[model samples]
Target: MALAGALLTGALAGCGDGPVRMGAAAVVGDDRISTAKLDQAVLDCQRQFKNDQVANQVRAALESQRQQQPMSGEPADCSPRSALDTMVNFEVAEAAAKTAGVSVTEGQVDQMIGLMGRQAPAESIVVALGMPKEYTRDVARMNAAQSLILQKLGADGNQQSPASLQARQQALSLFRQAAGKLDIRINPRFGSFDENRMTVSPVTTRLSATESGVR
Candidate 1:
């Protein structure tokens, strides 16, 4: 139900107007995901992960899962860069949904959250995924849109089924096409956009070893 694995794919081609706005993390079509929004999402993640004990517990659980399945690449950390990645993903998914004539309303999001509550604390799930509580509705809507898109592509939501796999591929293709049409751009301060992965990579910096570094 999460948008985590759904939005990652190769970059698409599109154009933007004028220059990117100052303090904007990324521009999706005419809309911008501002730095302030990115900061808030990162703060929410920090607040949730601040307790060392709980953070370790969650990290350990995730590590165990990774060991069993061996994910293709390193997992993203709960940092501002990753928050920006998530923001862009949702924007792209929304664009794709619009193109596919899929709509997810607030009531539908609430219903989905209620359904998910049967398995785990919905708030915990949202926070653990580095999404702000205030943005829970948006997250739910994004998930619903993704589900609808897959359904339209003939997926039954059984992720392991061949039909589901084919649907996922088609859905990703649609997202990529939508993203290209939208002409999304990211600020270099956060990272460069990896069209191959459809996510931001942390910028590399050369720190002077002799200079006083913050601990």
Candidate 2:
């Protein structure tokens, strides 16, 4: 699905540290984005290169240095663990919306797509979270789900009422449950997390080849 960062894609924003080797270290929830998985994905990008070259290229390309302003109490990276973290958050939120039987219309999706186009004139606006063109529909669904949750929460008046709190608690519990099921391990070469540190806002931006029409 179109994750938050995906939505913020192309906005010049930015992930992790571990072993000085190839692959995904751990999976956030049930999803395992292991080193081999990460390597294969990278290799897919530059098929002309050998496996060693592909691994090195990915190492060079992935975010290595911390750039974002540290949040008051957050880590430099969001540090969710694996790609599954995004999906876990999305699914939890989506499940909440589904429980309420919320529905969205095609017209609304079109409007959002239109708004993104207006917000980004130079960059193409095909999806909500900067996902691939093929995922536009999914992005619209995610946006709608977000809107539904916000609307209900706002209508509740107590905002932090028992039900609202329970919903949030349930979501977190599900995420933690999935995470516990995985065979996850963090490689020290990548970087260690500082539980006390926070990432600052106004994250650093990276130039996109798309803006330059390179590829």
Candidate 3:
């Protein structure tokens, strides 16, 4: 979710050209992220969200202390389409990595998750983002790839620096160019996919936003 550039969550955009292929939530190059897979991830987030809700209700009954579950209230946002967006985003990040000549190993991904675990249980880290606990490795790979992409491009990670800002724009441009060449498409049920912005617009706003013109 922290990829470089402006990822628009504001306006709705029209769906891309051509069909998204049956049962596939998205198609990133030859990789098919299936609807069943998206459903599983969404269901996982909902389960966690529901657990948080129930925990809150139980704690409300307590006369004294608050619940101390570290992973309880993640993903402050859980729209049904959100998971699909993330799944697609992860794939896009991987594609971008290949073009950037950056490669991530299993150990690197494990280390990434290990670092995240210091904050919260690795399994509990991404429920709020709608990623299934089983896909934690995928999320880590995305994070690793994004970090390496910026580093390779000489983009400073510090947000306040002008050089970093310019590097971020450059990174974004690289992602957009990579996306333009892939066979990427999103299922209408999940709204429209904007490759340049790497966002999925919901069905309600698909017709109002301008097309990203990505193939």
Candidate 4:
């Protein structure tokens, strides 16, 4: 998800100008990420979010504020569409790594997860981001793959360094190029891909403030 640059240079670089496979949330290369898979992931994430003490406290505070005065809009929360996006990103990143001949071992993934757990509870981070626990491995794989790609491109992992930033941009360009070749497709019900952002653009619906309060 950190990669930047156009994901597709043109329609020609996208999933073919043909109908997408039925019941598929997305297609990455030859693999289908079924709608069922996305639904299950979303359900898992929602359950974890509901059980997380921090998330519950935040929601309770939001509700308290809403009762005191008319809230402007609904509070932010994870959605199934967001889960679909996350899965798509994982698939794309994995495919890009494969294309680049980058490898990430299970041990590397576990190590990355351990490092993340130092900042905060890793499970809480995954749930807050609407990612299923099972996808944690994929998340670590993506991170490891990206880090390796950056190093291969001569980028030091220092965000504040101008040279590092430039090198990262160059690596991102390569990632995008590899992603473009995969012919990724997303179901229109979820949203379309934003070639410029190299990510899904979920469709937005604007509801009246009163209608929003009902939810």
Candidate 5:
């Protein structure tokens, strides 16, 4: 399914044909999310479950339904919204990494991928992220970059890097600090991703299997 969406993206670009086509901009404060970007997020999910035709069928359907629904009335953002938030978060992390003199080189990302082994970083990243290895290497790079940023921010004394509760807190603190004064407004479709008040709905009740229109 991910492969199909990827192949269809260029064909759908401005025509607004496929499920991956960019829809409308979900403007939040100064930030504006184009439908194309949102579509890409949806594709990411499809790519994750590419191994299971049944899962792909269900996910694609649910995505199609979501595309038609007006985001204005929905109060919760689901996983796709979470994906969007991650994008927003990545921007902040990139900026923070710059300030902290923390940079993730292609070599480093490659090293991380090597640690994960064979198929490629994109594939390894799916395992690392517990996500599907879809889209392209660029997506994998972004994921690796985000992971690097989190590791750097979350690192403690450096003796033995432990992904502990404190590390998560530190990473969040860095993220918030780096995000600084950016104003983000979530569309009603995507519920608030407040660290203190996160709300996730079961995918089954909110989405349908054939709604997204993916193969």
Candidate 6:
């Protein structure tokens, strides 16, 4: 139900538009995602992984009994840049959901997390995907909003009726408009972002990057 580990990230080289912001990992519209904030998030994720190793195993075992697919394996690098990419994607998805008139309330996030808890402790799954423990609710809200928006557009279902196709197009147009209005900017220290694909890949660089707990 959650991103199912399908994070759109890689170490692949790509180009991002807009100017780099000082001390900011990214700038989405008026808000800034600070580099320090991103680093702290990555640290939190790594710490959660280490602290919840047993919980992670418990989650796997529960999911197996339920016959649910396991969460996607962690990305090879779990790169700090990739961790930032998750935040960016969540931001974009939230904006798009708002624009589409799809709302995911606190109660909805609670329900989603409740469902996830049945698979394993929500914190364990969240950290397994390299997200900060503090973001567990925020992540649940975004994923819930994502599914709601897609279901509304009939994009998540198998039906390909003309009406469904039209709805899909409408969803795409809405997301594109939302993204364009945001005018996202990324720091070269992280990587380039492809708006069309909603994917972030590292750019060519000579600068050194320090990844706490990843070394």
TM-score per candidate: 0.77, 0.35, 0.73, 0.75, 0.49, 0.71
lDDT of each: 0.71, 0.39, 0.69, 0.68, 0.47, 0.70
State in Å the error of residue 198, model 1. 2.6
Native-to-model Cα distance after best TM-score fit, residue 146 in candidate 2, in Å: 0.5
Residue-by-residue lDDT tens digits, candidate 2, 1-215: 33444434431111222232234443332444455543443343233222234334333333342223332222211122322233333444455565656666788666655654563421123211222234455555656665565555443435578776765555445433433343233333223222112111233334356544468
Ranking by TM-score: 1, 4, 3, 6, 5, 2
lDDT of 5 by residue, 69-113 (tens): 855223222256555654555455566566656777778767666
lDDT at 172, model 5: 60
Query: Considering only N, C-alpha and C atoms within 3 Å, which residue pairs clash in candidate 1?
Result: 11-195
Relative to the true structure, candidate 6 reaches a TM of 0.71
Ordering by lDDT: 1, 6, 3, 4, 5, 2
Whole-model lDDT, model 2: 0.39
- For model 6, the local distance difference test gives 0.70
* Model 4 Cα lDDT, one tens digit per residue, 129-190: 66766777777777788877777667766876876788778777776776577777777667
| Error at 97, model 5, angstroms | 0.9
User: Residue 39 in model 5: shift from native, Å?
Assistant: 2.2
User: How big is the positional error of residue 108 in model 4, measured in Å on the Cα after superposition?
Assistant: 1.0
What TM value does model 2 have? 0.35
Specify the poorest-scoring 10-residue window by lDDT in model 1. 5-14
lDDT of 3 by residue, 51-139 (tens): 75433343243313324554343223446577877777777788889999999999999999998778466666665455656778988
lDDT of 6 at 2: 22
Displacement of residue 106 (Cα, Å) in model 5 is 1.6
Candidate 6 — which residues are off by over 4 angstroms? 1-18, 54-78, 155-173, 205-215
